[model samples]
Target: MMSTLAERIQKQDQRALAKAITMVDNDHPDKLSLLSEISGQEKKAHFIGLTGSPGAGKSSLVDRLITHIRNMDKTVAVIAVDPTSPFSGGALLGDRFRMHKHFADPGVFIRSMATRGSLGGLSRSTKDAIRVCDAFGFDYILIETVGVGQSELDIMKVADTTALVLTPNSGDVLQIFKAGIMEIADVFVINKADLPGVQKLKTQLKEFLHIADPKSWQPPIVETISTEHKGIEAFFEACEAHKKFLNETDAGKQKRKEQLTYEVYELMREELWKDVERFIGDDPSKEIALQKENDPYQLAKEWLSEWREKGGGS
Candidate 1:
């Protein structure tokens, strides 16, 4: 069944792709099996991450980028992480309204995922969503994150190109830099270039980059008025250049390899946590102990010792 779904994805069936992604988002029992079956069908889709503070016009920028990408006759998929709806516990599905024109186009796919209390401002399944998009043969996949300040570094683990969006006079740049986002940015986009202080922001970025002096890829800062669709071309050119660099330098491959290694450990950690939870939940004694214990360190030691004694250890 998973293979059939993967074959449908390889054929670019949108319904099949959406179903698979739903599996990922819901943490379905067959999610991993489906992902494994579809792994090899992945094409060379450029994964671009857009992150910034709220009111920095990230949605507008993404809207414009979708138009630009479609103008170039390429297929693109957008996975926008949105704040969870309090009632439904699902993505609020707001950004789609701004980019509504593209919904009619067959080559464009936009999905909103609820952050669901993830401190990093992204859905836990976003990387898997990107992989699912890759299998569907899109030319590009754009991930627009919710604007959680420091934890936005989660994008670094998933994106091939991390574009940090900022507004000229909004002080978004300072907050981003202070949060160490500068270290992960493959490109810097100043979205409201029509506003004052564009040059000042540029100067600050230059000074910071100069101090950092990265030996590999030096991130380029592009100014744009996303509302007017200006500088989208330049922004894309910078992305294209970085994509080429990744292809030529083997950096992209290494990044994915490292991500895969980390995913392995992450998966193991998640499984272990589930097992421990089940172990504790099934036993009234453990629950009573948990309620009574004040020393977390000793309680953890006792839990581990008991778990190992009960055939949990190798």
Candidate 2:
């Protein structure tokens, strides 16, 4: 049954892909076992992350990049993470609407995820969705996240390469530097290059790169008017160069290993929290402490004791 579902995924069946992703996202005990059985057998895919300030034309750039990847006869999967409404717990789903050109294409799979208050700016489901894409046999998987402060930095953990997008005249180039985005970016893109101050922004970025002297490989800056599909080839070339750099650097291998370790610990933490909640039932002692203005650390210790007593630690 798993093999059949996996085959359906490779055939680009949208329903199968969606279901498979949900299975992974749920992270149920049985599902985890199944995932382990099939994990190493899945084909590897190129993972790319795109992020920028809101209104930086990230969606448009992704649309154009998808076209470029398709032109290479490669299948693409896009996970576009949008902000959720705090009250409603729902996303606008606007990113999928922007990439309408690929709506009917089986070769392109696009999914919109709600950030769901994940601290690092990505949805908890984002990694699982990417795994589904990888298992589905996509040649390239692109992750697009809402560009808010330090949230965009989370993309570096998930993507093999990250592109920090900025508009030519948004004055965001300096913000990127201040936010420490410069350190995480494998490539920088000045999107909306047709706008005024394109040259100025490009010059500023070049100077910043020179000062940073980014170790062995310097991040390349590419200009793109994504709506017009201009300079996309150059952007792809930069992505390829970054990939080559990763292959040649020992740092890249260590980085990936650390990322995997983090993911494992993250998963374990979530599971342990769930176990605690389940042990305490609806009226958890931790929740009661929050109402009384009690010490959270003490309450946490109490909960942990209760949890272990209930065999949660087992």
Candidate 3:
């Protein structure tokens, strides 16, 4: 059954791709095997990240960008990460509603994902979902995060080009310096350019960029009125330019290496946590209930000593 699905995925069957993504998202038992089978088969899609403060209209911009990319005869895939509901472990998944117009187009694939309590504006399966889309032969994969924050920046690490979108008079321009966003952003978009204070925001961003001194490639600032589909072309062109710069310089190589290392560390941490849980028992509430007065550091030290004595790690 897995072999047949792998073959169908290789053939670019949408149904097969959807099934594979579902398995990855749900953390199915066969996920590792499926991902291994499809590893190294990506068609080299341009992975882009769109992130901003809520009400910055990132979804609308992505919708427009999809249309622009499709008009150029390129296939596209979108993974919209929405905030999860703490009470229900579910998400509104409202991005689908904004992008439903493309539903009839086979060339455009859209998936709405919940953050699932992950602080990084991405689920544990998001990187796997990216691979699924890339291996499915899409020309582009756009990852839209929930909002601009530390979690969003962490999530942007996977994107080859990340565009930080803002709007006029939203005070997001001030946020550029805080939260380490200035360092991570590859491009900036001032959405709702028609509104008041657009020029002031642009000036502030330019001044900040000038002071930041991005040596090899200065991030471009594009003013976009996404509702009118204006500036979409320039925004894409900036992305292309950034992609070219990355390819031509050592920055791109270094970034790829860093991303690989991060992935390895993340996976290792996940596995180690699981092993520790199994050894100590799964219910933390019980542990706390029994040892309410114990010092957490001392208990952790003892646990580590026992794990080492048992030859739990290499």
Residue-by-residue lDDT tens digits, candidate 3, 1-314: 35577778878999999999999989999998888888765348888999888899999999999999999999999998877766668777655776779999999999988777575467668888988888888989999887847546775578999998889967856665776776678899999999999989989988888888658889999999999999999999999999999889998888788877887798789778878878778547547745675577877787778877978855
Candidate 2 lDDT tens digits, 1-314 = 35566667666678988887777655545566545544677347888999888899988888888999999998899998877766666776654776888988888999887777574377657777787788878888999888886558788888988998888777757777887877788899998888999888988888888888658878889999988899999998899888878878896787678778878887799778877666666665556677897577887787777777877757
RMSD of 1: 2.3
Off by over 4 Å in 3: 1-3, 282-291
lDDT of each structure?
0.84, 0.80, 0.84
As a TM-score, model 2 comes out at: 0.89
Off by more than 4 A, model 1: 1-3, 41-43, 85-88, 93-95, 172-174
- What's the CA error at residue 1 for candidate 2, in Å? 7.9
Pairs with backbone N, CA or C atoms under 3 Å apart (clashes), candidate 1: none
**2 or 3, which is superior by lDDT?**
3
